[model samples]
Target: MDQVQESYDEFNLNFRIEDTVIVNQTEMEGFNAFFLGNQSTCQQSVVEGVRVLSYKIPATLPLGQFLKKQLYKGEFLSILSNILNQLLYFEDRNMPIKKVLLNTKYMYIELSNLHVQLIYMPIEKEFTDCNVCEFVQNFISKIRFADMQCVNCVDQILHYLDSRLMFSLREFYTFIIELQKEDILKDDIDLGEGETTVLQQMSYNNITPYLVRSRTNALIPIEKTEFLVGKSSECDYQIPDNRKVSRKHCSFRISNGECYIRDENSTNHTYVNGKMIQPGFDVMLKNDDYIRMGDEEFKYWVR
Candidate 1:
């Protein structure tokens, strides 16, 4: 097995709890208010539900003070509440819940919409045995879901939770890297000598350049092969106020769904995070990389 897969397996085996209680659809009605209507009412139901569920936990299991310290310090309660609110929102909106699995350490909510599954694990050593009720109460009270359509609801919730949940961002970044590696391997195996020779030209033709403006925070989706960035009126991305900017600053080219920036040999030059790229040479841009032309700065991102 590859290192990534091996690490993933190890993480699951060591940190994950095996047993889970699957909540039935018929039993979902009691929590309708929690999902569909009033926030206060929904929160109350969640608190009560967690208390009942806690009864199943083995009292003989050793309780450590360290665990309690971790729970209170981190955003475990907040994360749990956000997840429950999202699940309830899904349930109330007629979004099918394929399964709701509750374990001692985590909750997995599976939705029929896109077959998306959200796993929420509380921070280790954070919850004291005596603090479960308080945790639940805090979690429920903090939940405030905005009214949004079910289509992108899961993604929106996951995006919000990504910032709060520990290990989530790292896991997601690792998954993306694995996917990119697999894509490269597949490309290498499937290409013929003649086809491979033309691959770069063909791939360049198929690319779409997507960028985010740092100052305005606007998304610029580029469908063209080449995009010009400068102060000139003809440029695709114009920086008008920056006097240090040249008339034609830099050029961004889309190749194989990837973006590359090349300095147009402007007076002030172009840089990626303070590192100046030699004129006429392309610098491949990655997500969250800062691109600077003269004194003006922009952040590069892929959608």
Candidate 2:
């Protein structure tokens, strides 16, 4: 049984080692830097009186579990593109490429956005024997395509990888982009608004959106792409002296140039217009929309 403790910001995925020796903060931080996703921060703690190594997770499914659901061409490309992109990221920076966990059990994915998360141990020089070539081959062997009548970019990549002994990250990425063209852009996929509250994709890249507090008439700028709001000091927007507000209330995030809000399972909940939004879910905000966090209200402005 894998025991994970959930905090407001992130959940801790703990691994109990057989050594029984407590993992210090240094080792925990090193291990968690590889817990790739929205919440990359690391912390060390004890759970159930046992010494364990823990890492932050923002609720993603293991790649193996996620694959069990109906797989589409768009989703298939998204998953592969993300993994290849991660390899590219590591390669371009000249970072150690072995830190990327190649196995499906270690890899995670956010189904909503089709974003991939990889779990690796940065501290270990020899974490596993898995390498880029081995992973690529395993990935190819993992799944059988539904249709083989027509060749696609995916088939092309499999053929490309098979033909070459030396794998080049940039070359692989370039080939994927060239083959798919527009399909390579994962954001273009229609995440049906009814099922998921996807934020509005910015039409006018010229205009930047902002917010105005209704009470003080203060102008608030979006400083970060993911703007966290709450009464906690850790939040980007720290609301003070508000008993109705939770420490980590909600967040406004700009994904792929579009903006949206998510209720962070706060006690009072978040309201757009008049109705309260579901916790841990997204709600798209438009220009002139009123957002209420507890009693604090702000008018979203796009101009």
Candidate 3:
């Protein structure tokens, strides 16, 4: 029964489009010629031996109203089918173009309810060196999300650069949510608001999920290690405890070889290794690392 239910859900998502444009060939002076009845002229011309197609769609009536009527018979899919066929025909020629511009000004005239986005071909090499066509093809082929192994969703372009190029997380997360429904790093990820968390319930000896140095809370992932240090918030000359837990609610633990500290946004800044962190900065913990937060100081020892 579960298998059958899953099959039903799949079928619902892969719904079929019934309407489509019928393409036909015609004898012409240049490369190719065709027409949709007597409504518009479709001509494929070669300029300097490069094949290019020029077609026009009539907009005698307002396009917005016309599209509203067309949607009743599922004409949208039919139009897409026609456009896709033309693209495939160009692909068969073995000639590549940098960008394909579809005139959608008339589309806006009749199709108020529908929206269109223009995708340019031959993406910038600076951004991953993969063209827009390659990006789309990769998405259609071997892309999967929702995995610890898979780093990025196929629907979005993955351009991994150093932290220097990292943009605002807000803008990044917005783009991810559009391509993939889940954004794990979102600020409001918790299902419900609570006074205390599971980390508080777990014993520090058994599982220390977070570390505090200088009041900054750094979340510690299991099997990761980090460094510890101390410094004076009021004066640089002053040093704090080497091992400090933030807020008494959480402690840091290292399982593998990375150190981590959580930000409780304390008055004194936590300095991981040598980098002084703001309240929210998640400090990277490393083995034998130096950390100084507020009046606390510590050298991390790997167990």
User: Which candidate gets the maximum lDDT versus the true structure?
Assistant: 2
How many clashes show up per model? 5, 0, 40
lDDT winner, 2 or 3: 2
lDDT of 1: 0.44
**Candidate 2 C-alpha lDDT tens digits along 50-76:** 644566666457677777765556667
| Candidates in order: C-alpha RMSD to true structure | 20.1, 19.3, 22.2
lDDT of each: 0.44, 0.64, 0.33
Q: Which digits, one per residue and each the tens of the lDDT, describe model 1 over residues 1-303? A: 001111211211112222343433333344333332112111111232232121111122111211232332113323344444555554455433323322333321221111112322222122211222223334333434332222233333344333321122223333333433443554577555655432121111122346677767877765556889888999987888888888899998754334678999899989898999899998766557888788777887654
Q: Model 2: which residue pairs collide?
A: none
* Candidate 1 displacement at residue 53 in angstroms: 54
Q: Which 10 consecutive positions of candidate 2 have the poorest summed lDDT?
A: 198-207
- Ten residues in sequence with the least summed lDDT for candidate 3: 8-17
What is the Å distance of residue 165 in model 2 from its true position?
2.8
Query: In terms of TM-score, which candidate is strongest?
Result: 2
Candidate 3, 34-68: lDDT as tens digits: 32211223344444454433333332332233333
Off by over 4 Å in 1: 1-208
lDDT of model 3, residue 224:
29
